[model samples]
Target chain A: MSAFVSISLVYLAIYTLSAWSLNLQYGYAGIINFGWIVFQSIGAYVAATTALGSPTSGGFQTYIFGARLGFPLPLIMGTLAGAALALLLGLIILTRRIRPDFQAIIMLVVAIIAAEVVSTNTALFNGANGLSNVPQPFNGVMHLSYNNYQWFFVAFSFALCIIVYFGLEWICRSSWGRALRAMREDDILASHVGINVQALRIVVFVIGGAIAGFSGALLVEFLGTWSPDAWSFVESFVVFVSVYVGGRANNRGAIIGAFLVPVVFGTMPSFLPEFGYPGLSANLEWLVIAALWLTTFYLRPAGILPEGRFIARRTRAREQAPVMPPIAKQGSVA
Target chain B: MNLYIEAIGFGVIAASSIALGAMGFTLQFGLTNVLNVGYGATMSFGAIVAYAAHLTGMSIWLALICGGIATSGLTLLSAKTLLRVYAKRGAALFEMAMVTFGIALIVEYAIASITENNTFSLTIAIEHTHALGPIRFTDVQLALVILAVVVFILLDGFLRLTKVGTALRATAVDPDLARASGIATGRIVTIAWLLSGFLCGLAGGVFTIDILTVNAFTGDSLLSLVIVAALMGTAGSVRGAALAALLLGIATQLVSAAGASGYASAVAYGVLAVVLLARPKSVQGGLVADRVQITV
Candidate 1:
């Protein structure tokens, strides 16, 4: 395969993972977390910091948590870091009697602040230059060929995606999932029904963060580098677009949507004809994405496939019976 | 001590830009009740308009007016054509915000594509600074502060005294109730949009003059700060926004002066976080989670 295809696939895998995490949060849980990319950035930073080893006396950059974690530790650390931050923020913002829109703005502000902090403090991940020279997982031991590595990642990413997909599907299908749906529909009512709404949101938010981190770990290790540029507020929007374009509540829909939007729409721009200037094409690509967002909302407000409404059996019976038909209950049929 | 004074002076300048943006933002938000994320894009358009006018040998003041006019036209047009459509379709508050966000992306990206993502610089001629005690400011900065103060006094007077302003305030309180009271809610909404759009444009132009540079993401970068200021001031309070902007501006300056220049914006953000965490209840009305189905 050509370099372009390989690189595209790498981005696709990472974005797919990110979208999956968003799907779990916004889709199943109905949490309007506008600041979605912070978790991804955290995951990337943690993974990078852990894998780069310690900054020696003559080192060029400085960072905290600088230690060689080898293969699995970096990934674990990344996931945990993302989850921890989410838990902390969730406790503060997700609680309280504030408005959801305000909650979203707060999240966006938090993301902006996170980016600023990371860009400023060099010790926090080597500042804006970011962490590079990151070794691939198992490169020395496996001694894999280039093609082999690509295939290995493909298989590995696919396996993880499958596991996450199924794991999330199970969670969404269980009683816990029903509780979440209840909270999404009406938090106050859910609380009245004995559901600890705040706790539930925090738990799901943390889990979502972990998934985002895990995805970032998989991505950084595959690409062999991570930086502030790797994550931006725009990254959050990309995943969000996919979740909305696909069915919001369906896991399968989320994956399919992610592939279509990010893998296809996002990558296609690179191959387009050169526009007026160098970055013009990239700018037009975003224009197209924005147009797509508007068009989808206008054409398919409920997405390609709308989420199935879960009707209680008791309510289902009443719906079927129809207390009074518009046409006198079809007297002839009776 | 000198550095502290200088920071304070610079903070006031920054606050002037933020105050202009926030007032317009709050008006549109208060009356229409749409978050209007496209606000930043509109500001960018205004800046571009001003830049184009400048290239045509127009005076900066005239160019500023042109920018404000352009922004006002676009805001009213978008509100009538695009926003009305979604709003008519029963799109909720959050969905309206998403729609505006998408529109903003289109506007910003179009500008970027056309401009080739290059930054443009606009120099303001204000070499001389006046010293008062330890604080000093250039003629331009002084002008900005005066303009801000005038705008505040005028807005406050308008809101309190004028019939149109009364109607606007009434609509903000309850659109349905305002309509029932024989007030033309639609006309009031249009007035709010026009005024807000004009101010937004003026803010962008002023910002470019101060920073001496404009880019595609200029408005996007400042948007978070603007929102923070508006929200911290309680969204509907013009005076509150001014006060918040002043606080933010000073805090940012102080941080930069303290040698943590890279984290200056973070300091502003840190203030926002503390406010958010400390009094989440204060922001309850603004935080109501509305279901918005966004797709791309």
Candidate 2:
């Protein structure tokens, strides 16, 4: 396969993971994490900086906490960084008794704030210039051509995607997910039912944050570069558009929706005839995505592939059998 | 000491613009419960209208009125067409926000496509400067402050002293109750939309003049700050929003004066997050979750 196709597959896998994490949060848990992209940026920065070793300071880029680490360690560190950030923010956000709309706006504010802070405090993550020349995993061990290395990474990403997919699927099918649905329906009622709503939201948020970070780590490692420009607050909306357009509560819907929106539509801009200028297609791409979002809400609010109904299994055949009760005679009015 | 005083001066100017926008935002949000993210787009469109008027040699005051009228129409159109449709479908608060966001994207991008994404400078002819104590102000800035104060008095009086205003307050608190009380809740809502839309557009025009630049991306970028003020002030209270806007403005100006200019606008968000963390019950109104209706 061509390098282009391999690159596309890798993106598909990465976005699929992101969509899944966001889906779990917004879909099941009803935590509107509008700042989701910033967490991914954290993972990318941590992964890239750790893999790149110490910054030479005056020699080139400027950043804090530069250390030379092995491939797996950087990836692990990236995931941890994402979780740490989420754990910190979720502590405050989840504990609040605010409405969902308020929560969404707060998250939005955080997303914008994170971008400005990161770009402004250049010493933290090398500012707007960002980090480049990040080392790729198995670069020497595999001894493969660059194009083939991409294919390898794509396969690796897909494998990780499968693991995460099954893991999240298992969790969603558990009692925790049922509780999450209840909370989404009514927070006060959920708390009344003895469910620790705040604690559950925090748990789900952190887990989702970790997944987002992992995907970011995988993506940066594959690309061998990281930048503040890579993640914008609006990008979170794109991930949201995917999860929502796919199916709010369905994992399969998330995967398919990710593929359909980010994977397919994202790459389609390349095939479009150039209109006015070079960046025109890119502009039009976002426009199309926006149109797609509006169209989906109008036509199929339940998504193309709606969520499946969850029904618990019966253990015995007798339990599955239907029964009818005896009716009272019309004349027997005591 | 001198820079601190100077920053306070700038903060007041910033606050004036922010206050106008926040007042409008809080008004619509308090009554409609749409959390209309597309407000940013409407603001930009309004500013654009003002910009067009200025190009045609209209005075700054006329431009503001023109923009305000245009924005009011746009706001009502959006509320009636887009937001009402979704609300009718029983879309929840967050879903309504998503719909508004989609509308915002369309408006912002269409402007971008039309304007070709170019930044246009707003010309404010500041003829003279008046100085008092350690502060100095251009005539344009003075006019803005006056505009803000006048709008506030008018809106406050409109919301308090009039029968429609009473009806609006009633509708805001409980739409069904207001409807049952023979209040013509629909007309009051339409009036709210008009008044808020005017404020929204007026704010846009004032912001462009104050900042000295206008662009397709202008309103959306300023939106976060506006929202922070509106939310922090308590959604339905105009006085609360105005005071919050003033505080935010001062904080941002002080931050910028301290040299971290990029993080200045972020102060509003910091205030919000800190407030949320500090007082959950107060912020959530003591554990009573009010389901906000998106319709009039």
Candidate 3:
């Protein structure tokens, strides 16, 4: 009922943010960041650690940077944590012009290894069980109903999304975004145009990381739990599929694609008839996604809303004409 | 000292699996210039096929052949059918990787659905161990290492001596030039796919044998380690892959033995990152703008 609507809205908003963050990276910039989820995971982990206070007293979980930060501090720290990882990774990968595929493989490997570490290290985010019972902001002061909380979250997240959307849109249309587009089309040409291709890539990458961090923070604040299950390599693919299916290089398309895939394709299966085994339906979900990915990849590689071509403004008739006196112009020839 | 010996033994055994997988991966990637992320899924498919055959009471040797053939057929079909379509359409390297990833997801999920995502264990009854000086080794481990060495020697010999192998190496270096020189580049690529696929399948089967478990995600997990080994070897060099595999296996084992259990995978990834940073050339392969193009 109303509670479900609230929860669903929160989920939708959070996923939209994640999708938008990815759009900034893969759409505007040609960087194939296959391991995008790692940034989000770091953000969630950091935000949780900061809010949980110290683990020295042997709490349920042990994590670094325990500080019980009140409100905005946790969210800010989350963004910083994600940006830090991006900077570190960018410094390493952005050094030379490696093949894009190799770059992707490296990211995928980093994410897989990262997930394994998080799951195995009991002291780090309480191992696979993850940190739970995280207190939501204003939960104590507001004393709101579950439905109200949902509405509140939906409103708050949408507000953040609007800011991010406008901010990202402005940035993409800016000189920096143009440089990214140029780089995407042809790095050599972009470089010839006096653009520092590598530097531009890193800048956009860090920005994308920041967005991812904010998205992760928003998600954790809403869900009240963070675990390894929340971020899987397959989940990364799901996001990629959404972006690709919706339209590459189109923010609106990306948002629409994200909503359609995660909500319709990903969530709808749960409500269907019980399959062979309990998890069979879940397994089939991935199969459908794969089929959808391949279909889109082959049929519409450019996506539904492809990158729009920039057109120049029309000039007046007089301006369009050469507007030269024929005698004066032919004097030299005569 | 015994613990160190045990780690070394395990490292050697693990290295055999990586070596086989890496050699196949390097060869396929070298010639095709495709990352082939679906390779791990194909490996898993091979392992499952072998496991199913074993469950059906087939001889282990026959199961190995069946798995190898099955993987080879799948690889060839994928390369000829789907990959060729994209390649013909001039898909970027990254786009190809995406395609392969999609294919892998499909294959893996299909297998998961079929198997019900159950973990099947295949225990090797190798209780007997032989002591060589201060180190002890199991029969299966010894056999695996020996098999890896034999594969290395045979592959090296083939590449150096045979006409087909010479054509493969020529094509690997320059497909267009090889084609201009009247070599059937298509046939060569197909043969490469078949051989590499067979080797990948064998690696998968051996991996399951060593781990004594078969699961859909087994090859997916092993893919990174194999890539590390392949990349470390500088790609296209079988000997280098084997040596790198040995190093990686030893390094991971040592890290785990040092009580840094959680960071062991991280340690391996750390090596990959270092290699990436240190040797960017290995990743680029002379193509500055080469987007990942994984056909099969």
Candidate 3: regions farther than 4 A off: A1-4, A271-273, A311-334, B285-288, B291-296
The digit string of per-residue lDDT tens for model 3 on A1-334 reads 6765666667677777778778878887788889999999899888888877787675567776678889887788889888999988988777577777777878887888889888988677888998887778777789998778778888888888888889877887777777888888788888899999888888788988887887788778778899999998777788888888888778888877787777667876776789698799988888888888888778888887887764222444556678775555655756
**Pairs clashing within candidate 1:** A99-B287, A99-B288, A100-B287, A100-B288, A100-B289, A101-B287, A102-B287
Give the alpha carbon lDDT tens digit for every residue of A111-147 in model 1: 8888888887887788888888888888879988888
Global lDDT of model 2? 0.85
| Docking level for model 2 | acceptable
lDDT of 3 by residue, B1-296 (tens): 77777777788888888888899988888888887889899999989999988888897768877988899999888888888888888888877778888888888889998888899999667778988766677887788788888988898888889999999999888777888999998888888899889988888988988888999988986788898888888778878888999999888887877778677768888888778767876776322356443333
CA shift of A178, model 3, Å:
1.4
When 2 and 3 are scored with lDDT, the better candidate is 2
Q: Could you tell me how far off, in angstroms, the CA of residue B116 lies in candidate 3 after the best superposition?
A: 0.8
Model 2's DockQ score: 0.45
Candidate 2, residues B1-296, lDDT tens digits: the string is 99989999999999998899999999988888888888888889888989999899999899989999999998889888877887887787878898889888888888888888788997676799999778899999999999999989998998999888888999999999999989888888899899889988988888899998998778976687788888888787899889998888889999999998898987778888777556555345322234666774
Give model 2's TM-score versus the native structure. Answer: 0.94
In candidate 3, the residue pairs with backbone N, CA or C atoms under 3 Å apart (3 or more residues apart, or in different chains) clash, namely: B93-B291, B93-B292, B93-B293, B94-B292
